[model samples]
Target: MDNEDKKQDIKDDENKEQNIEKEIDNNKISDEDKKNTEKDNIDSSKNTSSKSSLETKERDWFFEPKKDGSPSTVPSDVENVIKNHSTYFLGDTSEKVIYLTFDEGYENGYTGKILDVLKANNIKAAFFVVTPYIKTNKDLIKRMVDEGHLVCNHSVHHPSMAQVALKSKEKFKEEFTGVEEIFKEVTGKEMPKFFRPPMGKYSELSLAYTKELGYKTIFWSFAYNDWNVDKQPDPESAKKRIVDKAHNGAIYLLHAVSKTNTEILDSVIKELKAKGFRFASLEELK
Candidate 1:
C-alpha cells in the first residue's frame, strides 16, 4: 500500500482494538444487565425516605466494620446528613486528645473508684445518666457536677433514642426533661446540652430532635464489649486495646459498671498519657 493508505489502515486497526476493549469490558453482563445495575445503584442511593418507610424498625447504630488502625469512623450515610449538624463522634484533629465518657445505668459501686482515678489524674469526663440513675445516685451525680465534670442526658428510661426520639416527640421530650429535672434537683445546676443516645443507638431524626432540643449528640470513636458487668474484660488486655487504638480526637465509651474498667482506668489513663495522649471533656467538642 502507499504511505497514506498504510496510515489509514493503521488507524482502522486502532479503532478495531478499541471496539474489542469495549466488548471485553461488557463481558458477563449484557447491556440490559448494565442498565438494571445502574438503576439499582441510583435507587440504593436515595436517602429521602423517613424511618416510617421501613417495616421492621430496628434502631440503627453505627459501628466500624473494620479496624485497620485508623481512627474509627461512621457510616457515610450517617456522616453525610449530620456533617456540620452538631453531631460529634470525635474531637478536633489538632492534637492527641481523648474524651472520656461513661454511661451510668445504675452504678455498680465502681463509679466512685472511677471518679477517684479521674480526680487523681485531674482529667474531667462527661457522665451520661438516666432518670433512674438520677434518683439512685444523687450524691454521685452531684459529685460529678461539683467536681466540674459534665453531666449529659442519656434519656429518662434509657430507651434507644432511634426508637423514641423521632417516633414520639412528647415521649422524647419527657425522657430528657425528666432527667434534667432530676439532675437540676440534685446538682442545683442545669444539665449541660450534651446527649449520648442509649446503647449508641440513633437515627438521623433522633439526632435532629436532640439538636432541636438544644443538645449536641455524642457518639464514640472507640468502644468495646465493656458494657457487661458480669463479663469484664481482662484489665491488661483491655488497656492494650485502648492504648493501641489511641489516636488524635478519640472518644471512648466505657461503662461505669465494669469492674475491669474500674481496675484499669488509672493504668489506662497513665498509659495513654505516657503515649502522649491527653484526656479532655466532651465540653471541649461542644
Candidate 2:
C-alpha cells in the first residue's frame, strides 16, 4: 500500500471510533431517562396513598354518610338557660377584641344578609350550626369557609347543651357529634374545635364530655333578647345594648333570624369600631 492509502485507512478508523462513542452516550442517556420516569411514578403513588389516608381519617371522625332530619325549634327551658347563664363562655382576654357567633338552629331568612354585613365590614365570625343548616345551606357554609369564617357544631336537634342532666352524657355526645357529622358530609372539612352548647345550657357533665370529644365550648358575654319573634326589641335599642356592652375579649351572641339584628348590625359595627374594639374570629382569641 502507498502512503496516501495508509493515511485514508487511519482516517476511516478514527471516524468509526467517534461513531461508537456517540452511540454509547445516547444509550446512557436513555437509561437515565427510564430511571427518572420510574422515580416520578413512585413519588406520585406515595402522594396518592398519603392523600387517601388523610381523607379517611377526616371522614371517620367528622361526617355522617347521609342527612338525618330537620332541626327542632328552640325549646323554652333551653331559652331560659341561655337567658340566665351565658357569662362564663366569655374568654378572659384584655385586648380590644370581640368575638361574634350566630346560632343556626333554624333559619328565619336573615343569615345571608347577616353574612353580607359581615363581609362588608371585613369581619369574620363563628356560626354554630345544626344538621338542617348544614344540609340545606351548603352555599352559605361554603361562603363562610371561603370567606374565612368558622363553622362549629350546635347539636343535631338543637337541644340545649346545658339542660342535659348529669345522667345523659351519652346523649350530649350524640347531639354534638351528629352536627359534626353533617358538617363534614356537606363540606368535607372538619368542624371547628369550638362549640356552642345549644341554648348555652351546658352542665359539668356535658362540658366534660365535649372536652373529651376535642372541643372548646364558646359562650358569649353580650347578647340581647333577640330570639323572640313576638316581641323583637327595636333595632335602635338592640344596637344601643350591643354597643354599650362592646369590650375587649367580649363574645357577642346574635340570632341570625332576627330582623332587628340585621337592621342594627351596621350601626353596631360602626359603634364598636368607634369604641376602639376590633372584631375577630374565635380562633384569633385562642
Candidate 3:
C-alpha cells in the first residue's frame, strides 16, 4: 500500500479505538446511575413507610371543653382519623342532645344507683363493660340490657387496644369477641356492635380493626377526672363541670366506678334537661 494510504488506515484505527473507549465510559456511568437511582427509590420507600407508621400511631382522645355551650373542638387530624373509621365523638351539632356513656371497668357499688337515675330520667345510656365487669356483675349487665340500655364491649382484658392490634389482628379480634361470647351467654342475645377503647387509648389501625368487626367506636366530647375513685372530683364541682360543658352534641363520659358520678348524675341530667338538652341513645346519634 502507499504510505499515505497506510497513514489514513492508522488514523481510522485510532478513531475506532477512541469511540470504543467512550462507549465503555458511558456504560460505566450508566451503571453508577442505575445504582444511585435504586438507592434513591429505597430511601423514598423507607420515608413513605415511616410516614405511614406515624399516621397510625396510638392516640389519646382529647377535646377542648367550652363552657359557653359551644361544640367542643377536637384536633382536625384526630377528628379525621375517627371519622374515617366510622367512629363518633359527638352527634348532631344542630340539636341539643347529649349521649351519656358509662365506662364500667369494675364494680364500685354505684352502677345500680346510676342506672336508677337513668331509669328515672327515661334516659337510655350505653354502658361499656370489660369482661371482668360482665363476668362478675352479670345481674347488672342483665339490668342494663333489660332497661333498654346498651351493653357494649370494652375489651376482654382492657389492654391498650392499639398495641394489641399492632401485635396481632387475631388477638385484637379476641379482645372484642371474647366479651361478646360471654355477653351472649349471659343475655341469650347477640351483643350490640358498639365499642369503647380501654382508657380512651386508640389508633387508626385499632379503629380500623374495630370497624371491620362491624362496631362503631364511641369516643366522648366531655369527660372529667372521674375514673379515679380515690381522687374523685367534688360532686358539686363535677356537676358544674358537666353542666357547664354541655354543648349541643356532647358525649359525656362518666365512670360508673365514681361515687361522685352516682351522686350527681341525676342532678346533672335534670339541669341539662332544664337547659333543653335531651339525652340520646347511641343508636340515635345523628
Candidate 4:
C-alpha cells in the first residue's frame, strides 16, 4: 500500500510540469503575434504619411498664401495661367535678343541637365529661386551664382500679389519685403532689384508696391505647357514652338522640370544663334 501511494504522487508531479510547459509555449506565441501587429501598424502609418506629403505638394502648385501666411484663396482655374505669364516673349525692339529665365521651385528632376546645357553652350540665364529651393539646393544655387548666372527672387511662398488688398503701406511692405527677406536669409545677400509675381497675376497696386520697394516687375510673354509632367510635349514640338514664337526681347519662361526643355535646349540655342539672335540675361537688358 505504501509503494502504490508514492508512485501516484510522482505521476501527479509529472503532469503538473507538462501543463506549465504548455502555458509557457502559448505565452511565447502570443508575444510574437503582438510584435508583428505592432510592426504592421508602424508600416501603415509611414505609408499614410508619404501619401499625405505627395497630396500636399500637388495641391500647393497653385494656391496663394492667405492673410495668415497659410495656403488660402486658391483659384483652381486661373492660377496656373496667371503664374506662367512671367515668361513673356516680347519681340526684339532695339536688338535681336531673347531673355531666358528658369523658375526653380523644387526639383522635378531636370534642373541639372538644363544647367549643363546652358553651361556647355557658354550662355547665361537668370534663375528665380524660392527660399526652400535656395536652402536645400544651395550647392546648385551657388554654382549658378558662381558661374555668372543671375539669381533672382521668385517670392518666399510664391504668393500671388493680385490677391492682396494693399490698403496700407504695411501691405505693400509685405508683398515686396517679404520675398526680399527670404533671399537675404538664405544667401546672405540683399535682393531689392527685381521680382516676379508668384503667378503672372498682379494688380496695378501690386506693381506700384514693387516699384516703391525698388524692384522692377518681371513678366514673360512666351511659355509652353511644360509644367504638366505626365503630358509632356515632344522634343521636336517643343523646339519648334519655341524657335517659331521667339521674337526680339522675348523672355521665354521654361520650367526646369520639363524633359522636352532638356532634350531640345541645345538645338534651340543653336537655331536661335543661326537666326541672328543673341541671348541676354535679365540684368543685361534695359
Please tell me which predicted candidate would have the highest lDDT against the true structure.
3
Model 3 scores a C-alpha lDDT of: 0.90
Give the residue spans of candidate 1 off by over 4 A.
Answer: 1-59, 65-69
The residue-by-residue lDDT of candidate 1 on 1-286, one tens digit each, is 8999999999999999999988977774687798899988777666445444432233555657235556677777667756754888879667889999999988799998988999999999999999999898888988888888999999888888777854578887888899999888998889999988888777666777777799998888888988887788888899899888887788888899898899989988998999888888787884
20 Cα displacement, candidate 4 (Å): 99
Question: How many clashes show up in model 4?
Answer: 14
Report the alpha-carbon TM-score of model 1 versus the true structure. Answer: 0.77
Residues 40-82, model 4: lDDT tens digits: 9999989987534321111112323233222123354434433
TM-score of 3: 0.81
Q: Higher-TM-score candidate among 1 and 4?
A: 1
In terms of lDDT, the poorest run of 10 residues in model 1 is: 50-59
Judged by lDDT relative to the true structure, which candidate is superior, 2 or 4? Answer: 2
Return whichever of 1 and 3 wins on lDDT: 3
Please report, as a residue range, the 10-residue window in candidate 2 with the lowest summed lDDT: 55-64
- Candidate 4 stretches with Cα past 4 Å from truth are 1-92, 165-168
RMSD of each: 14.0, 16.9, 5.7, 20.8
lDDT of 3 by residue, 1-286 (tens): 9999999999999999999999999999999999999999999999987546635588888888776679988888887777778788898889999999999888989989998999999999999988888889999999999999999999999999889988888999999999999999999989989899998899988998898999999998988899888898998988988898899888888899998999988899899999999988899864
